[model samples]
Target: MTVADVQLFVTSAVGGAMVGETVEGIARYPINLRYPQSWRDSPQALRQLPILTPMKQQITLADVADVKVSTGPSMLKTENARPTSWIYIDARDRDMVSVVHDLQKAIAEKVQLKPGTSVAFSGQFELLERANHKLKLMVPMTLMIIFVLLYLAFRRVGEALLIISSVPFALVGGIWLLWWMGFHLSVATGTGFIALAGVAAEFGVVMLMYLRHAIEAEPSLNNPQTFSEQKLDEALYHGRGPARAPESDDGGGDYRWSAADSVWNGSRFRGDEPDCRADDWRHDHRAFAIAVYYPGGI
Candidate 1:
């Protein structure tokens, strides 16, 4: 008999019945017919299996084909057409960066690779590395753009720089909150900080606008010779023009006014306070206003 005939006979006998079915009530069940377990228990039993040829002659399977057990993979996996092995790690109660850092160090110290063998780390850590590289370029560009926009809006380098400087003070609370919550720095946190910076800059701009409008509305405060720290402080506290009316009900105006009062009170209540003039008081007022309003964005 041909190899195909032998293969078909052996497979049909051992692979169980394909066309048998049983009906019970309205349900149907498949039937698998094969040699009894005792008759097909080992390699020798399988080897002695009978096969029929077209000539009506019976021959044993061992006469045509070899049947023996051996060891090999049931399934093979490959990457880039090369066989690969995978190692999976799960980090718990710690940050992924630190875990991976320790893992890399351990591997470097303990594992050695043969020629043509190399190890590459991937997954979330890979994405983090890529994001970090992008942020290095993106963050400074973002700050520069914000500064440029602030400069465009105010047309003054000092004011733009002032707003930019306020961003760090804005971020301090968020950084502390993250620390309290046991959060590690990541891409998500970096993006949040960028957004916070923008908001801080906006608050600074609003505070500057309020101060400028208050000074402009009172012609006396604009004149250098007439300007005094006490007069400026009074003007800042009670400066309610058309610009202040709409913001009063919105909570922002009250916050800004209260912030100004806090700075004035801080300076007025201090026994060892220096005799700072109007410029220093104005600077302190601006800084205090920014500190108070910055949290509103969060």
Candidate 2:
């Protein structure tokens, strides 16, 4: 900003859309930096000489917001430039609309109202701050809803706790990954957090579902007619137990199928359990095989 002879330093294509290299080459034809050019009829090739290096990083629409133009604003304030002639005020801290309003006032009141080019801007801090606050409120409520869902899906409180606790850990890992990749936490980052939450709970849901299926099949546990300790430890912590546990019916001599071993195989859950003369409920392998491992178990 030049006050006396300050012709207000202006770069035509600094942030404008019309600043293309091809267009500039065409506009500045017969271009010579150090040497005189003998203009030929053919289009002039730009003479190579090092001048000022420009910043070439691209800024996307997602990274910017709030661009406004006002009717009232000043370009140059005084007729003759003085020490106090140049005014660069951060009027945004006040009534934001007034920032532009003040600029408009300057132009209307100033002597040099015929100034050529002035300022260009994109994005606003206040608007971004407000939007971010709204999302912060939304994030916690969403996390709470997920916690309720986990609690309802798994009857035990401990199971829900385990799943919910992992939420922060997973998010931290994701943030670290994105940060290392040169990405900042922005509006898209909120979406990423939501995606991670669902994925983390998916594993917890599958584990709980498998445990439920095994519990319903065990006859020796808490069945329609029996209450025994045969499946006490296995049901408490499933899939991690011993391979060949005592089958519930024949007092430590009966063989049984493990659900976890054959979950993907489809052979363990063959068919409905068969009943005996005594009406004792048991995991019948004959029925199990036909039902679980039927024709081409998919």
Candidate 3:
């Protein structure tokens, strides 16, 4: 028989009779099985299926088409309505950005793409790029806000600028600490640096304010009486500072305390009296406050 005649006969009679036709929605939540499951469960069973019937003009599937069993991809993937496959490369002991950068460079140098095929570096690299873009805008905005707030607080452009300048110094220490701790600069690290900058700026402002107050309230050495209580208030902010001088370590009549002796033994009172250690004074909040406020002996 001719190829078309054989094809028509085999499709209609033998294979169709054995395999049966698939019907959808034949029953509610049920599959309609015209043939048993064992009919074509294996390649051997499929090959042994009857392709010819005795009563009809004889035809065989072998005469019409070539059918050879072989293995193929279990599943296919598509992206953007086009067939695609992923080749994943993982990073260990290296940064994702640098790895992706080197990959792009190498691919550009050595690899060639076909007409319909393409490649992309995604995952962490894509996320990092997005984060960097956001930070680019956020960093400048944060700095502007800090400058404006400092200017409002200090009421002087010079003081604001000076305080803001210390932010970088604070960031240097933070960056170094991060590096020492074996951490890469990420969003969290940037956030911590921002916090550090705020604290550094605050300290700068406080120091500048104290210096300005001291300079404004300086007393002349010519007349001791001219240093009134008002001048003392101006210097110490209305008795907020030390009320009494830190005593000397020496009781050698009018002898003075050495820096080392003061730090080691603390201040001494009268002869043969028990002394408070410098370490104790440091730990005691009241003693610390007294020492800081009164650098000179009363």
Candidate 4:
């Protein structure tokens, strides 16, 4: 029999109802023509089904083609007009970047693809690559904006550059801490470094402001010709004195000039008065900067 005849008959007899009819005052009923289930239960039974050729010759279905069971994919899948297969992997106890890197190396060394075949990596690794690319551009732009703002605030290239320089120091400290904790660099950590740059710039500006005020308070140290190490130290010593004297029983207090007070409220010296001969301001400045910037005691 012809292929079309076989298909038409098989669809009508086995697939489903070929059509439906409606009767007045009655629901629609389907018109179907199928053999009893027992008559077509196995391949052997199917092979015995009768077929009428155009020449009016009677024959069995087995005379046309072989019939047997086989195995295949339940459904076909394709990508870009080509068949495709999917393999999923999950990483454990390792960073995504390193895991993907090792996977790529192993695939390249061992897995062989036939002609016209290609493999692509995606998912989180794809997102990471995109983020890293944007960060490369964003980080430099962020630094440039910060430098411009610093220059506008201080109105001096030297002072702006000085504040901008502190960002690298803060970044180094952040990187060191990450390394110590065995953490990988990611979008979250990069964002944190951006925040760190802002904080470092703020601290640098405050420190610079206090140092300038200290120099301006002393005439001899203000001038470049008479500015000496000893005179500068004397200015810092007085500039970093307690912000306010101890309150008296009458609820009254005296205000004192203090650089550390700009950062820490109610900061005081070791005693009622600062010892000029000692280098206490240096220590206090370091301690205050550390305490303010790294409250966790880094």
Which 10 consecutive positions of candidate 3 have the poorest summed lDDT? 270-279
Q: Write the per-residue lDDT of candidate 4 for residues 24-46, one digit (tens) a residue.
A: 67666666657777657888987
For candidate 2, give the lDDT of residue 4: 24
lDDT, candidate 3, residue 16?
Answer: 45
| Candidate 3 C-alpha lDDT tens digits along 154-180 | 798877776666566445544544455
- TM-scores for the candidates: 0.62, 0.33, 0.56, 0.59
- Report backbone clashes per prediction: 0, 13, 0, 0
Q: lDDT by residue for model 2 over 215-248, one digit each (tens)?
A: 6667666564665555644563553122113212
Decreasing TM-score order of the candidates: 1, 4, 3, 2
User: What lDDT would candidate 2 get against the real structure?
Assistant: 0.42
- Could you tell me the C-alpha RMSD of candidate 1 in Å? 12.5
Off by over 4 Å in 4: 1-75, 224-226, 234-298
lDDT of 3 at 169: 48
Q: Which ten residues in a row have the lowest lDDT in candidate 1?
A: 271-280
Clashing pairs in 1: none
Angstrom error of the Cα, residue 174, model 2: value is 1.7
